[model samples]
Target chain A: MKGMTVIVKTITSWVKILIFLFGIYIILFGHLTPGGGFAGGVILASSYILIMLAYGRDFVEENLSLPAASRIDCLGAFSFAMIAILGLVFGGSFFVNFLFQKYLPGQPLNLVSAGTIPLSNIAIGLKVGASLFLVIVSLSICCKDFRPGTSVNKKKE
Target chain B: MIIFYCLLIFMLIAAIVAVETEKLLSSVICIGAIGFGASLMFLFLRAPDIAITQIVVEVLGLIILIRATISRDLTFITGDREFFEVVVSVVIVFVIFLAGIQVLQTLPDFGSPIFAQVADAPSNTYVSRGLGKTGAANLVTSVILDFRAYDTLGEATVLFTSIIGATVILRKKCRKKMEETTG
Candidate 1:
């Protein structure tokens, strides 16, 4: 059983690495390609799911506790909302792009040419990553039988 | 015409997958793919703004649905009612396709003079003002923040609400049970 677990873990780790790299590619080329923050984030979350499935719920819970993930989700959302609010303070409308000036240095049609767009992509990437992680974690945890004393009582009483 | 045919094929495949899958999780995944394809179609039709919004909302909705379904262990379709499901899904898809083609046919072309005039005037004015005043290089930023600040505020409120909702929904029910027993 232990050996089987290790094999599964190795496979899952490779899959996670592939997904993580694919997500990076999507976000990096979001401006010029069809992929963007939303797609990239989903890909990132699938990595976490792979880890969970391969290693079991206890392993995932130990590594990425529900509380820690929830906090990250909250923080990511707050940061994104705060950035949008900053525009109001700067006398811009709402999501007023106040972050950068010139587009990033590349050809006009290059993937890296869009300046603030990439920043938006990053912000969205973080938000989606953390939130989707939390969602998956919450689902898995909720489905688990975590109630105390039930099994103990069955053994004793 | 080839592009249109390609889109039609993709849509058909998506619909078929969404209907034929026995596992609910796989069905949900297929639906999400359909949403992505629809967004791509929107972009191809020169509606980038709609495409972005569609992607955002569809992703969020899919995540929420997946979470709910998984938590409840509702991950498989049951019964010998597969035929019924397939027929119903086909009818629904056909109705939507008819409406979609009708709308597409009636809509004005992308480069129509009316759209050009509207886009040139408002977006140009906003871009110049944004550059002059806001010191931002992105035109969409100026339009969203400076020209339409109120919408941004509303968007922030929407985010806040979702955060609160998630917290409430995911709170530990066992803790409440323990508190009830102690009280």
Candidate 2:
């Protein structure tokens, strides 16, 4: 499909950054706020999806590129498991609160509190955001059979 | 109370419209309306975490559905509607709804969990000591990440698998130009 109108692209350029920042806020403040890793991650992906909608497949692929997203997804999975396994090694139990228990008994409601929760949140957030972006990219790419500079042959609804 | 019921009714009407709409895009929008309605319900119920998740998921779902519908034609005409199948499905849905209502009636209460009565339950400890143990103000986050990290790990793994499968199958370049070999 062709990139949307100039209005959409212009607005997307400005708003996408804000949305991306908000998603990061949600992810980092998961322990203190109502949003968490999953929700924040989905929000992040939607920010990219908005760009994909405003721009076209080529732009997104050029920037976010399939391979980069795949690597991030793998890194997220690896880091999350490592966090869990590290808990077992340190706290003598799987998924234990090793940081809060031993290293730092953080004060509640503080941004830097919540031992490993924030780390896990970041890991999950990266994994989800990248995967959702990957899914959308793949789906859109599969339908990009049309030639450039032409509108998709969409049937009248 | 009245607003909750209103939202529920709105969602029901939107759901019906989604099922009845002729245009796939319109149907997707109507389904999105239903999701937003539920998200509003969650907000009214004071679960901002769930409301945020629901709204984002709904947006993504709407986007994906609209993208798929615009790209491909999914209308199928199997001519001669299967009345028997429809009837059976509707009957089953109604029975399930009735059974659910009965189960809900037997439940302790809405909004408040039965942690007090069940002293040995994990929820009791979570409600009482979640902040102290996890050092997170949000008990929901503490429970999900600290107490139940295993489930979250499994969920992330599932998403990873699905996304990997999608990408592997839908490579941008296909080997269509490969020379045909007769075995």
Candidate 3:
């Protein structure tokens, strides 16, 4: 898509960074706040959506390609499963808090205190944000009417 | 107390309007509004974490709904079968409402401490032992990621399945369009 008016593009360019940063903050500080992986992931996806709306598909593709997003999605899921398996290997349970118990220092409310929780949050945030962005991108690309000024058709030819 | 009931009434009205609306976009927006209202109700019920989750889910849901609706021509037809289906749905909804009232009457009042002493009451344990067990200040996060990791895994799996299904369903059509354009 060619995207919207210049005003929207300009404003989004400035605002999207803040939104993305806020999403990371939420994911990292999930153990201390109301927002966790899922909510932070949605926020991250929304930031990307804002960019797509303002800068169009080509811009998003250049910055974060579809294949890269898919890779990130898989990487996130793999990391989460690895964490669970680590729990089973060390603690004799599928999802036990082995790191918190055996290795990591436990301090309440600290960012580094939660052993597997924060790791899980990051993994989940990556998986959810990438997947949702992929969903929206795929759906919009499939739209029969809203092709971007014959560029895509020309490329196909 | 009165405000909570008022919110509930608003939620009911929103639901009815969402079901009755002719325009699919409008209906989806109304459902998003219902989610917003329900999040407010969750906050009033002293569950900020749930409220946040509800609002974020509402946003993603609205995005999906709008995208899905954009490509389709949505027109409503009220025929005999449609009317019959509507009546059946309404009856089922009313029956469920009555049953919910009956169940609510049998339960303890809101904020009753007796709930903490049940045999498998995780709420009390989470509140009492959660911070020490997980080194997380938020009890809900600890419960979800530490005490109940399997459920979170399942939820993640469901999300993965949905995205995969959406991709598969649309990938072929998109590829076909590209091929046709190329040829």
Candidate 4:
């Protein structure tokens, strides 16, 4: 039974890795393809769900505590907001691209040319990832009623 | 046009399933599926931003509904007037569906001057800067972070509010228990 559990976990981890990699591909190709941060983020979160299903709630809690996930979520949102505010501080309209400087080669349509687009993508990816993680974990934890020693009722001896 | 008709048919089926289902969980899932279909329709209508927002909001709403429903008694009666309600709902759905189809057929395409003006105006600054500064190939990022930063701020606030609400509601029982133990 223990070995079977291990085999199942291994398979789940592999599936999760594949999903994570696919998410990365989607984000990387977001500009050139149909997928973007929102799609990629949900896909990544589904990977985490796969692991949780295979390994159990304890495994997930051990790897990603609710507090830590919450903090990451807050930080992601704060950073995205900060980036927008930075544009305003730079004498540009809110969210205006004000910090981009011309790079070497000056080739347009190249991967290294867009000024703030990449940063925005990263910020969006972070926000989506954190939000999805928080959502899934919160839902799971709220429904975690079958865990041992979680009840307050006592039996009379 | 045929694809549009198919989508309309599917949406009608989804709505029927959502309302007529006896089980709360099934109803919730069906509603969520309808939300997904609506978002897809939004994308087809060339409203990507609205689609993304709708999808996220629907997912969050579904999660909340599921959590709330799980704790409540969801058994309800739909007495003799059930058929009337179903007929009324189908009529409402068909009316809205026909209106949507008509609107889509009549709306201006992307080549219109207003769309061109917005696409070519200062917002294009993101595209230019994105090519010149950010080294990223995605134009959406340029628009999101550079051209419309304020909207991103609002989105972040929405996320923050959602997280806070989820934590507060989910922690209530734990807080009550802690107070009882301390008292």
Candidate 5:
């Protein structure tokens, strides 16, 4: 997991942050833009994955560990549920746009005016990002250890 | 248009190459080319949301596919499963077959429309009143996060469940290491 050559590493260091920011832009401006939470979240995960490719899996696991990713995954799901339930509590039924209806109803085509859309986008983005990352990381781990006809990696515990 | 035809042809060629290639890694990359071509087609059709999703998901999928294939031999998955797996899969397939028959029976007749009145369809309603109701310029966002919020919720839950399943199935080696170190 020592990563690629100096050239790839340098280029990735320069470009990963930009990709991360673009993902955030997509998620935040989803109400006015073409991309939404899922797209942005995939981009976000790929930014980290780009780093993984250039700097190796150990570097990534150090920055964002497996346990921490799982935690974020849980937190993202919990926050989305909280948002939906908040709509039910404040407004009438489930998933009502409570902000647009009751509180802080702003004009259209403006940021900070999509009511609960942006909040939901952010929650979904977090959930999707963490989920994809976890899947890739776990699959990589399994693939690395499970060589054909090699049960040596497994020890009876 | 010519562009549509070109992309369609390119994708068809790429799909053929991906299927017929001898090198597994090259095949995986060709699959990625087909995905990108589809993404471009989506863009041409004025569906940028789907285009963005397609490209990113393809990138992630390509990474996973390449990683899974990079260190494998040709003889890697040739029927090394346990007897338990064999029995379980048979049961699962039988159940799914029954469910599929029931589902096919319940499906509407061919060429039947879900909505009798096109104007009353949910998409039309979303397009007409979405801007005022949700104050979002993007109709897709408003529909996904507001009108059909439950669907998004279900999607997020599905993603969560999949990650949990992956971790549970694949982390046994790490778990064993942790236990030995703790002991």
Candidate 6:
């Protein structure tokens, strides 16, 4: 849980919020941009990772928590499945695009016209972001002694 | 084309340097550079979607790989049999390269359409029909999420399963330790 010096913490505190916001923007605007669910998810996870590195694992766990991350991951996957199943029920095929109900040529360029693409993107973004954060958190837990400034005397106290 | 070849050669050099580096950290850095170069190459290939994906995936992979190496000893002794393994690997690579060249020769001209003259060429179909069919401006998104949704579903399942595996593998020992302490 012990973190780095004041410089890293200070910089990270300011920058992490921007990274998180950027990630959300990417996820939300995925249908219109180069970055989509996976890329945005990774960026989101990186923001968390930045927080973890600058503040400490204890700080991240206290705020986000490992269990919460796992739950979010499961929820993301479930939502994606639910969306797909809904498609099957309404559109007669698995993972069909049925939400927006319009597939006109010029309609595609608009933000809200892509039936299930944006929704699916959101689902994937959530899943990827949460899972990646969990993976990093779990891996960090495996190497407790590897972190810098793990004072042996502090452990005794 | 010249730029592409230049980037490719640089990538090749980076790969070789990554392999030959004695320090694991340096090797990791070299590999990351290779990945970055590759993403740039992907961009030059006119596939912005793939380039973005490549960059993000490369960074994620680099983070994980670096974390794995962080606690491990950086230096490893080169064994006597390494030479033989290298030779065998080189031979295999050469054979693959030759086979790839042969395949390329059999195919149509480079940079030309694979299905040039066909009425139902896949590229043509996707380009012409993607937006109308899926109502997504991004043709790649439409192709992935609507046209080939099943493949995407399978990919999602794979990712979910892998994460499950990671969590289970890492959680087991901690859970057992906690149980023992409580008991």
Per-prediction fnat values?
0.05, 0.86, 0.65, 0.39, 0.92, 0.60
Per residue, candidate 2 scores C-alpha lDDT tens digits across B127-146 of 89899888999999999999
Docking class of 2: medium
Please write out the lDDT profile of model 6 over residues B56-168, one tens digit for every residue: 87887787778667666544526455688889999999999999999878777767776675667687888887776777878887787778778877888898899888888
Chain A TM-scores, candidates in order: 0.74, 0.90, 0.90, 0.77, 0.93, 0.87
Q: Provide the lDDT at A35 for model 4.
A: 56
* Ordering by DockQ: 5, 2, 3, 6, 4, 1
Across A6-99, the per-residue lDDT of candidate 3 in tens digits comes to 9999999899999899999989999998889988998999899888878887799788888899898889888888999999999898989888
Indicate which candidate wins on DockQ: 5
Per TM-score, the best of the predicted structures is 2
Order of candidates by lDDT, top first?
2, 5, 3, 6, 4, 1
Tens digits of per-residue lDDT for model 2, A1-157 = 6699999999999999999999999999999999999999999999999999999878888888889999999998899999999999999999998999999877888888989999999999999999999998887766665322233223211
Report the C-alpha lDDT of model 5 over B102-141, residue by residue, as the tens digit: 9988655644544543546676678788999999999999
| B106 Cα displacement, candidate 4 (Å) | 7.5
Count of steric clashes across candidates, in order: 5, 0, 0, 14, 0, 0
Pairwise TM-score winner, candidates 5 and 6? 6
TM-score to true structure, per model: 0.59, 0.91, 0.88, 0.69, 0.83, 0.88
Cα deviation of A129, candidate 4, in Å: 1.5
Docking class of 5: medium
* Chain B vs. true chain B: TM-score per candidate: 0.59, 0.87, 0.81, 0.56, 0.71, 0.85
Q: Once model 2 is optimally superposed onto the true structure by TM-score, how far is the C-alpha of residue B36 displaced, in angstroms?
A: 0.3
Clashing residue pairs in candidate 3, if any? none
Q: Rate the local accuracy (lDDT) of all candidates.
A: 0.63, 0.87, 0.85, 0.65, 0.87, 0.82
Worst 10 residues of 3 chain B by lDDT: B72-81
Error (Å) of candidate 6 at residue B94 is: 2.7
Q: Model 6 over residues A1-157: C-alpha lDDT tens digits? A: 5888999999998999999999998888888877788788888998998888888888998889888998989988898899899988988878878776534223656777788888888998999999999988888776664333343345455
